[model samples]
Target: MELNQIYNNAREKMKGYCKVCPFCDGKACRGEVPGMGGAGTGSAFQANIEAWQRYKLEMRTIHQVQNPSTELELFGVKLTTPIIKAPVTGSSYNMGGSLSEEEYADIVVEGSKEFGTIAMTGDGADPTMYNSGLEAIKQADGFGIAIIKPRSQKEIIKRIKEAEKVGALAVGVDIDGAGLITMALKGQPVGPKSKEEIEELVNSTDLPFILKGIMTLDEARIAAEAGVDAIVVSNHGGRVLDSTPGTADVLAEIVSEVGGRIKILVDGGIRSGVDVLKALALGANGVLVARPLIIGVFGGEKEGFKMILEKMTTELKKAMILTGCESLGAVKGNILRKLND
Candidate 1:
């Protein structure tokens, strides 16, 4: 199926929930948190796109690099690309229930596998929300990850054990979701963890531990000291707060503090392969994609999802080759200059 057809179907399916905007920038859906828009005026969400757009790729044609490698490996899981589907849930409430939580999980997990990458499933107030992802990952031979909300430590460890039982590639908590009143309203309270509390969770799990929503150098340092395998430089897609800097703006600072000490993944406003390359240049080990991929899922299911990944991989390689990057290792901040520069 063609790309246009996929979006057309998505627009029809996600009419009330999402407009399936030509560009999934935050403008069209501002303040629509029950849906897909960012928290308040949507400035944070727009900042994500703007942050990436401000960096122009410096072209260098006089290079021997013919093909660029997009290969990424996380916790020993080899991936053909660096795009991991961001953890998203609330199919019934947040997404219009066009697809159930289980259906979405199955498609994303299988789709990620199809693209030779892995996905991260989310947790919420609803038990089934997290369980659906676990079941799908279990069906896929534990090829996906489970991201829990920042609930109590005992509860988190219990969920971690569940992830371990499924032989998951990794387990994590969306510590950014601590401020989510929605979870508390539903009787499951989530809050920020102390450094010691975080360390306990890390020590309790044998599987690779990931701490999502690290936007500061201090937290990145703490996560490193606590011994997490990876830290996602994110702001919960600007859903948890308003008027915050985009993940891209803070990623470099965080990376400078703990780049080699811990694996760094980042999300927000990552709409294309060029965005993926930009994130890597800024020091992210990988990038997480959501809004656009959600369109892919709503429109064409697995094939549509894989098609987006294919386009991103192709665009990334083309961008890398033109930028004199033969591999991900060669991508550096020097290859990018701010538009204002």
Candidate 2:
């Protein structure tokens, strides 16, 4: 079955039929969680369906029909598309351990290589998961990035060194996940403290550094000025901040502030080609995806992920054609029509 149909089928399969989406568990649906809504059909598969539908509608323009190339150049690596699978940890938290870190990286590596981009391994520095990433890196021939959610300054440095030793193109420091409100509200421990530790890690690494969880222009500017290779404007899939603005809402601000200085990637609530278009228009260099990867893992594994990539790439190309854009560079700010406008 198609990815979208699978998502719809899953959604229909949910019990209780509450107006509130299970994805948000009532927070995002009611706006109590604020920017929690619009997180891509609640998973990757559904987001692909939504993107496909939007692509059909938006492909009337020359850019959309031509299907503009979604390729991106980050630091020195060239990618086939701007859509990246954001690294998500704690897969065992859901799915009863269906996706071990190694198996997940293997699938991501296969799909990313086939699609011509980098898949980020969601190790989060767990010894078991980190070991899995090492194996997957060798198996996939290192076609992806190793994202480390560090628990300490020393661990952060160690993770970056390991990634570099494995020849990873880059090491993403997921500092944005530091403030998970649910965990905090529950009196559970949160992530590490202070950007100083992160700054130290960046200094420790020779490889290009990507700082995720940047929200405001100040943070973007600061990271750029601090010499980060890329700034990922994200809120950790709304799993961290409770009422933060959607990454899209802040993309322009962050992009405009840091565009010439660093590569700006946006995540959170992006589910379609149109969403990607909006991000590019708002000035993002690329988009990162999370829950969709989960859906792909659940529904079809590696091949399922490859199909998701193809469909999203096709939809992005269609959107580009409709917008009269022939290349990623041509997706300008004028294409986005704000609510106030």
Candidate 2: which stretches are off by over 4 Å? 4-67, 181-196
Runs of candidate 1 exceeding 4 Å displacement? none
For residues 62-140, write the lDDT of model 1, one tens digit per residue.
9799977889978887899999999999887677788889999999999998789999999987977999999999999
Which candidate has the highest lDDT of all? Answer: 1
Clashes of each: 0, 13
Q: TM-scores across all candidates?
A: 0.98, 0.81
Q: Tens digits of per-residue lDDT for model 2 on 267-291?
A: 7766666777777877888888765
Predicted structure 1: lDDT = 0.90
Worst 10 residues of 2 by lDDT: 30-39
